[model samples]
Target chain A: MKLAEAVAALSLEVEDPQILDREVEGGYCSDLLSDVMAKAAGGSIWVTNQVHANVVAVASLIDAAAVIIAGGMQPEEETVKKAQDVGIPLLSTSLSAFDVVGRLYELGLRGTLRDG
Target chain B: MPDVKDVGALMSVTYDVAARDFVRAGEAASKLKRLLQQLGLDPAVIRRAAIAAYEAEMNIVIHSYGGQIKVDITPESIEMICEDSGPGIPDIEKALQEGYSTATEEIREMGFGAGMGLPNIQRSADQFRIESTVGEGTCLQVTILHEAGE
Candidate 1:
């Protein structure tokens, strides 16, 4: 699915719309940057509540499709700047991380396994 | 035949990592990633190098007073040297175990300090080495080789 469709389907606020057309292969939810760095697939969407610049770094490193900051968390200015600079779409939702993950799963977004 | 000296060239860059600076922790790794990408390296190799560097960078930020990370990339492989000055790990074996950590509450709140940094670094690198002394500091060296095919 395209990031745009996922955003609309989950009612996520598009903090950066520049990358809405990027392809979303699947989803991986984690707050730990290392886990995301070591496991997230190239085109997967990352669902997490961690709103920091490192999050952007991990997303860019693993080539994650986009980052969805859950629980209505507002990212720091630097975090948003980094995401925009790296051309990764950053989204936010009022729901909790679990809720967001559940909704994305229901929307047919599977988790990209580490080896797969 | 071409000059033997021209067979391989080494490029090195160094960045300073500040302790407890969560905001700037990943800058060094990000720069390294950009450099690797511009060099036309394989994407998987670049990702592995970036992950190892980032993990080392975060360890310095979370545990040490401060440190320096120097990345030396050659035609054959990428090597990262991370040296920090602070209290050192007393037991390397214990520290390498998953889920064993000495991180403070503050660091844990940032979603790091989960006892995965070193393990993740080791997993990401083709070669890894570590040395430390109590009340002094720690040094980590990680290398990721370019695969034979690429």
Candidate 2:
């Protein structure tokens, strides 16, 4: 699935629409940056409740497709700026992480497993 | 053939890290990763190196008073010497254990302080060594080979 499609389907608030042409090959939901680094695969969309700038760092490091900050929590100014600068779409929605994940699953996005 | 006098360092850089500077916390690691990519290192190796380096950077940002991480990259390996001055770890053994962190509620709320930083670095490095002295400082020396057998 394309990140734009997912964003549209979920009505996600994109921090900037200039960088949503990525493919959503998989997804990983975690607030812990370490966990995300260890497991999230490249091209996977990261779902998290964290709005810290570190979220942007982890997402870009793993080459995540995009970051969907769940539960409507807007990210810090620096995070949004870094996301734009790094070309990772910083998105948010009123839905919780669980809710967003479920919606993404229904949209044909799958979670990435370590062994897979 | 004669011995090459200076073939050890392909590139080297040192980044200063400030304590509790969450706004710019990950920039050092990001710069290091970008350098590796520019060198055209294997993507997998770059990811591992970036992860370890980022975790180490975060440790200093969240825990230490201030520190510096020096990166050394060669043809075959990447070496990071991360050092922080003062308020060192009391128990290296306990600090290395997963699920044991001294972070405050604020740090935990930032999605770090999970007690997995060192272990995560260990998982990403080919060689990892950490030492610290109370009231002195902490020192971490990590090396990740370019051609990891992953």
| Predicted structure with the largest DockQ when compared to the true one | 2
Docking class of 1: medium
How high is each candidate's interface RMSD, in Å? 2.7, 2.0
Residue-level error in angstroms, candidate 2, position A49: 1.0
Fraction of the reference Cα-Cα interface contacts (below 8 Å) that each candidate reproduces:
0.73, 0.68
Q: Write the per-residue lDDT of candidate 2 for residues B1-150, one digit (tens) a residue.
A: 111233456677888888989888888888888878988998888888888889999999999999998887888798999999979999999999999999999899888999999998988889999999999899999999987765
Give candidate 1 misplaced runs (Cα > 4 Å).
Answer: B1-8, B148-150
Enumerate the chain B TM-scores of all models. Answer: 0.91, 0.93
**Cα displacement (Å) at residue A96, model 1:** 2.1
lDDT of 1 at A108: 91
Model 1 collision count: 0
Q: List the residue pairs that clash in candidate 2.
A: none
| lDDT per residue (tens digit) for residues A1-116 in model 2 | 88899999999999999888888898999998888988898899999999988888888888899999999898999898888888889999999999999999999888995431
For residues B1-150, write the lDDT of model 1, one tens digit per residue.
Answer: 101122348887888899988877787888888888988998888888888888898999989999998888888888889999999999999998887889988777778988888998888888899999999999999989998321
TM-score of chain A of each: 0.95, 0.96
